[model samples]
Target: MIGSGIGAPEKYRKVVVEKLGYVTGLQLSLRENLFDAAQNFDDLAKVSSELRLLASCLIKFAKDLRLLSSGPEAGFPYRE
Candidate 1:
């Protein structure tokens, strides 16, 4: 999406990829411990909530970039 959306430079894109990797790791850990709390579910739920909060920001960023790449025409993908 980065390549087809904003044409982010390779170096900057690499940084985004690295950060996404961290997000993946956190997601996996939360999944593994999702039910470990059983009753309270405090820690796992907090981590999940925080991840989702961060995801909202990323979602907005992606949407804005998509709109920018699309300009006034939303009929087709930018790269095509």
Candidate 2:
């Protein structure tokens, strides 16, 4: 009865919100990890390459999620 208007399924809206939260967390974690990697780059010289690549991948994923979450009125508009 709460969401008795527009079409889109409530479950789908919940899924999108959940995904946004997850992506936010991932972005924060990736930022922290990237910082740590930079700080210890000298100590972990040989493994820096892998760490950099991993950080790059995480950043890309976060960016993609951010784009997906953009324009509430346009993409997957959900009512609370």
Tell me, what's the RMSD of every candidate?
18.7, 23.9
Q: Please give each candidate's TM-score.
A: 0.40, 0.34
Q: Each candidate: what lDDT?
A: 0.59, 0.61
The best candidate in terms of TM-score: 1
In candidate 1, position 53 carries an lDDT of: 96
- Per-residue accuracy of model 1 over 1-80 as CA lDDT, tens digit each: 21142355656655665777797774321122223434465766899999999999999998888777774467345574
TM-score of 2: 0.34
- What tens-digit string does per-residue lDDT give for candidate 2 at 28-70? 2122243455555565575888899999999999989877876
